[model samples]
Target: MAPTTLVLNAGSSSIKFALYRAGDDVSLALRYKGKLDHHAGDVHFRITDAAGRELTAPDAHGHADDPTSALLERLEPLLGDDDIVEVGHRVVHGGPDFVEPVQVDDAILRRLDALSPLAPLHQQIGLAAIRTIMRTRPALRQIACFDTAFHHDMPPVYRNFALPDLGADIRRYGFHGLSFAYIASRLDAHQRRTVVAHLGSGASVCALLDGRSINTSMSFTPLDGLMMATRSGAIDPALVLYLQRTREMCIEAVENLLYHRSGLLGVSGSSADMRTLIGERNAGARQAVAQFCARAAEHMASMMTALRGCDAIVFTGGIGENSPEIRASICDHLAWLGLRLDPVLNASGAGVITCDRSEIVARVIETNEELVIAREVRRLTQSRH
Candidate 1:
């Protein structure tokens, strides 16, 4: 049996996982990929082969309340007789420490758990998966690939807030670093000054100068930056204060409002799924879509300011890669930067969407955060051997 590396990328509502065959030379090859989506109180699990062919029936796994346990149960059958080695997790927050991928131990897990407040929506989920694996497969090695690592080197000007030094850990520790890093790897060397918009359930804009993050929209937490599927994104600090002081809402209630009840769902008063909102004829849905696109464009422009100018704008993540209408709408707002999309290319939803004469090149690139995790796992494991 071939030695394999398992990568788990836990998000707010789902856990994406992939198995990669680890060769003796430290090369990685895709084996299988799947997602355990626990959205709207429903649990669904599915897996696909390297060629994108469905390897399991749609109704293979029944609904379950616990996503973590369900994930392991469903994944066991797929493992068959393969010899699994290490597990790599995409942890959302690494705080001021862990600028690179690190092996997870009890002490490290405790430190990571303390960062839950920083990334309330995502950190615990990833950490929970890590802890579960450690419990069930105690002998197996586990590694953590942080989402904030890519922005660890961001300039202080972009990383710090205007507030006094409350703590060293309090800074613009950007999320989606794994996604940004993958996008950077795909960009041409000439595309030094780039603004990447990772639009999805959790969205953020990043400025890449010389293929390195110089600035990003998310600050301190994933709840900052562009409005997401359910997140309120950047809001006035006074609004939060007012909600607490005058509205008499408790801290937990306010956190729930911003993290779970706001954004597209709050604005539309219907759904948070962009695909659903796009097809709806309701005025609320239309407004939600408009706001999402506008806010994304505004944030992208903000990232451009960090780069001084932008040579290219790359769109990745769920909405960015699949939603042509969204890509066009966002680019429409950026027309002032001489960015024009070829209607044909935009509709195709692949490759360069920008016109030949456009000053800023725009393209759609599918991000592989799982692959990034797997690569990190490979590097860590190889070094030990």
Candidate 2:
């Protein structure tokens, strides 16, 4: 059996995994994709082949030290005889230290753990998986592919803040870079000036000029850009202070409120998922969807300005690629900018959705962050040999 490469993206309650067959020439192709969703006391594990066919329905129950260990235990037997030679992780933050993907070591793990405070929701979970992999497969090489690395070279002017006393290292370090990088790779010559809107539960917009990240909606933290499913994005600092003084809320409570209880859930008093919000025929739900569209449209215009002018707008992520209604709404708002969407094409899902006569082109492209991670793993590991 040829050696396979495993790519892991660990979230707070979910771990997305992909296995790839690495060619002798350093090319990578996805073999299997799966996810483990742990909620309450139940553990749901499912795996599918590259063609979306179910290969195994493994019985995954209970938890060990963490979900990573539990997931690895269930997945080991399902891999058959394929040997996993290397592992790659989608680490959300590398701070100012790491500008490229690096092989994991003891000191590197410690440095990544120290960055937990910057990205509380993501770092801890990712580290847990990394440690679990280390314990389980000590012989396997692991790589840390940072989401912040792609935007590390953005212009200093856009990266800086207005604070006078702020240190040189403190600046806007954008997130969703892996997604942006994948989208940037798919752009053609005419789409040099593109605004890619990645509208998932956690959303952000990025402007790429000649495939380089010039500006993005996300700032120092992922919570600073577009309002997400549960995150209150881009709120005034004064409001937080007012809540502390008047509402007697502590720092932790305020953080919890903003990061876990706001956005669509707080606004609609319903579920956080966009599909749920769209299905509900209520004022609150409708208003919630409307607010998301409006805020996304507003940020997209700002991103376009960052590119001087937009040649094309590419939409990816959960809501961006699937929800035709949401896409139409956002395009309608940008109609004044000479963007015209074909209803038939938009509803059909994928490819160019814009009218040929439109001044600007719009496309729907599915992002593959795992492929990028796997490629990086092969590149970095092969370079060492």
Candidate 3:
């Protein structure tokens, strides 16, 4: 039978699963991709084969309360022993220790549970999914893939908080590692010391040096760094304190505003979706785009400090890959650094959409994080005794 690896990305309200087959020469390629969305109107799931051909049409269940269980139940009919061999899980926070893929066990589960506070939305869901899997199959070969692993190479100078090391914590550990790592691994073939703009609704940048993470835009948590769809991005903690002192606002409320109600949507008073905002060109829409471009360039400068300079700037994610307007706006500010986005190529969906002669190159490239996770699962599972 062909070897198969299953990769799971467990989010707060969704669980995305992908099955990949490790080819005869050990090349990992996706076989099936699907997702289960919960807490919505109705629990719905759909799966597609490697070619994205629908393997199963949309299936619905009326108000499935548990997302993990909902995902598991819907997935049961679609998978069999011949379909899945090993599993890879996306764990958001690895704290200070788990910087590499490791076999999941009791100690790892305990640590993941403890780190739930660091990534309240993601980690809890990851643990919940892991628990559900454990209950469903007690002896499955599973591995924990760390989102912080790629940033583990950051120097002490870059990682430290400068305020007395507090119990090996309070240090900066970047997120979106699996996505960033997939990009970083492929960057060397494209350019040296490249800056990757992962501009989704939730966005961040990673500066790659020689195919390793030198610096990244996001710091400590996803809420820090650049302006996102809803995240405030690198706001002054003093503002929260002031709100608490002057208005008696609680921590949860402040967090909710900063993490959920701010950014493009907050300022736009319209929508977080960039394409929608860009279309309207309203005062709020213009402001949101301007703020996004400004903050992106600002953080790019910081990441450059780690690499002295960059050879290229690669754009990925939903907005980064599709929105030519945002790409143009960002490149406008980067002109001083010699980045000139080729208008014809940028609009045409060409992969390397940068002016050939431009010194600081800019291009768009779609990322495949599930394939990366599948590779890790294959590697770890193959090593098992």
* Top of the candidates by lDDT: 1
Candidate 3 CA-lDDT value: 0.80
Q: Which pairs, if any, clash in model 1?
A: none
Candidate 1 Cα RMSD (Å): 1.8
Off by over 4 Å in 1: 38-43, 57-63, 76-81
lDDT of 2 at 154: 93
Tens digit per residue, CA lDDT, model 2, 2-116: 7899899888778889999888879887788888888887788888888999876755777833787787677667578878888999999989998899999889999999988
Instruction: Candidate 3: list runs displaced more than 4 Å.
Output: 23-26, 56-58, 70-81
Q: Report residue 331 deviation for candidate 2 (angstroms).
A: 0.8
Per-residue lDDT over 1-385 for candidate 1, one digit per residue giving the tens place of the 0 to 100 score:
8888988987667789999998888799898898888866678878899999987565434444467667766766777788778889999999999998999999999999999899888888899888887877888889999999999989989988999999988788998999999999999999999999999999999999999999999988899989998999999989999999999999999999999999999999999999999999999999999999999999999999999999999999999999999999999999998998999999998689988999999989999999989998899888887
What local lDDT score does residue 239 receive in model 1, on the 0 to 100 scale?
95
Q: Estimate each model's TM-score.
A: 0.95, 0.96, 0.93
* Candidate with maximal TM-score: 2
TM-score of model 3 vs. true structure:
0.93
Per-candidate clashes come to 0, 0, 0
Among residues 3 or more apart in sequence or in different chains, the pairs in candidate 2 whose N, CA or C atoms overlap within 3 Å are none
Arrange candidates by TM-score, descending: 2, 1, 3
Q: Give the alpha-carbon lDDT of every model.
A: 0.90, 0.89, 0.80
